[model samples]
Target: MPFPPKANGLFYNSLPPESIYNATPTALEQPFTPKMTVCEERQSLRKRYQFPEEPVDRYVAALSEMAPNCAFGPLENEMVRDQPIEGISSEGIRERLLSIPDFTLEKPLTASQQMEIAKKDAALFSIPDLTAAVQSTESTSFSSFRGTGDLLRPTPPCFRCGRASHLASCSNCHAKHARCRKRDKLGHFAQVCGSVKPSSQHEVVHSVSAVCFTDIRRYHIKTQC
Candidate 1:
């Protein structure tokens, strides 16, 4: 068999050593490895040396000229006495015959034509008094609360309670993790989580101030002692 590729680590390991040793009676004897062919040796060298592939066939047109197109072509020509004439092409044949129209219409209607027909149909069914009906009377007026930013802004849920409110963080909730009820990522409820920024800076400042005040009071006590 040919030698394995370069990646196979055991290719050179299979070769038996030339050293001779006395065989023990208790030890199992190994069979001697036979000499490999020159082809196998060449194949082993290919793995170690990277050689570019060279095509075995340099020219194929010469071989093609020696052999006929088909085996039966010469045999079939024996019955024919005159030279063969070329037949008419499809374009020439179609030009000679009268064309028959296809039954189906590929395009039912153009985009503009369909749109115009739709507008006419809609107008026929539409109420003539629609404009007056949509308009507001002199006594009646419409007002929208949407214009107010504070009122229009969606209420965010409390971080602790998991309920929708105006608070930045949730309170009065017993949940272990104050994760958002909707996305489950934010510490606050989904409603307010988008708008509520954590007050970590304020809490940090308060803790620092408390620590400083306690240290000053302790120093005063130490001086009195």
Candidate 2:
């Protein structure tokens, strides 16, 4: 009678019950939270924090940012205080911090104090410009000798025969014992030695003396004629 009760609508029967959609969400289905908790995040940051090659002040600023998120309440100060000592990029600074009579792991300096020491050490000690120093050394080593022309005007004469040029066949060099008083050696004559005393005749002497300064030490080098 009423169109056979509308044939019991197949679409309506196929739909899920309303209660299934309204049921409470399981743990997996709940609103998402970060997998890493505050402690874990803080630990991760601590593990990764290291002294950068930049200025110590920059490192201090970066390290300070981690303090707000720290979960280790009382121990946070110690952690911050020791980070620079343990993770410093500079060995000199690390050693300086370690050498402090009052500084120890059990009784570490305050973060600010540690930072102050680090800044002072950074200012006091610097990596020497070795490349520039080396270039300077090379220049000094190869520089022309002073008063060289005045010492030996007409080119140096040979020590054996007092001539401008000496031949192997020269009898004096081979016959006489070549004694070098300046060098205290017997192989060469004193006249050809770099440290030879000036002769009364103002004879031309080929000698070079170089003075070099290194590490607050002086070195003198002499060359023979």
Candidate 3:
């Protein structure tokens, strides 16, 4: 006789996307081991339930109360925290949650609470677990490369500079200032104004000017020596 249609659950309606079975290689050239059973089990579990994303902080507290003798250390708390149950089964969840204590905030078992002298057990334990390495690999491979593409691409010219590059690095322009003049403007002193007329024009004369005849060779160096 065939099994009833409802033998499994809602996920059984359609044939699974991939063959549940697959071949595996053995150390020897033996025939491949069938993987259909394993694949189907994973698929069924994936379809049946979802795990909670929130930190199990409250659950942790409850567990501590319930399992005083069970000694879950900081590392254990972290191990539990880092685990992702996104598709865990309800039974699995029950197993996990029931493992914790059954304490709630309002009823802190007066006598038990009194005796428990609630010393804050710091939840700080650093076990260099593989999570960091896994996260680093994921970020560098998936996220960091995508992020870097934008940062390294050349940006449009700055609006302030109106040039094809960084405004701050533009040597062709200067910042607006109270005492500064624009490059094209002659609002400031003449470039030659600081020098005195030579004591004699002869000092200023060039060989090209035969008509110039002042005799003295020098005068005060200029406006401000």
Best by lDDT: 2
The list of candidate 2 runs beyond 4 A from truth reads 1-36, 95-225
Candidate 1 per-residue lDDT, tens place, 1-225, comes to: 764676244533443453223332212234344655655643332232211231112111222232233232553232111100011122322222213232111111122234445656887768668645544321122212112322444544444444554343334454325567777874445655545344643464466666655655565455445
Cα RMSD, model 1 = 32.4
- Stretches off by above 4 angstroms in model 3 are 1-133, 168-225
Candidate 1 ranges with C-alpha deviation above 4 Å: 1-187, 191-225
Better of 1 and 2 by TM-score: 2
State, as a TM-score between 0 and 1, how close model 2 is to the true structure.
0.35
Best prediction by TM-score = 2
Clash statistics: count for each candidate: 5, 0, 6
lDDT of 1: 0.37
**What TM-score would every model get versus the actual structure?**
0.15, 0.35, 0.17
Tens-place lDDT per residue, model 3, 1-225, is 865668534334333455433321221233354534544643443343333532234433433343323334444443333222342323444344434465332222232232223322322233346657755765555445445543554434323333335432355433211122333432222232223222322332343132211111111122112
Q: Tell me the tens digit of each residue's lDDT in model 2 across 179-204.
A: 66766766556665653223512433
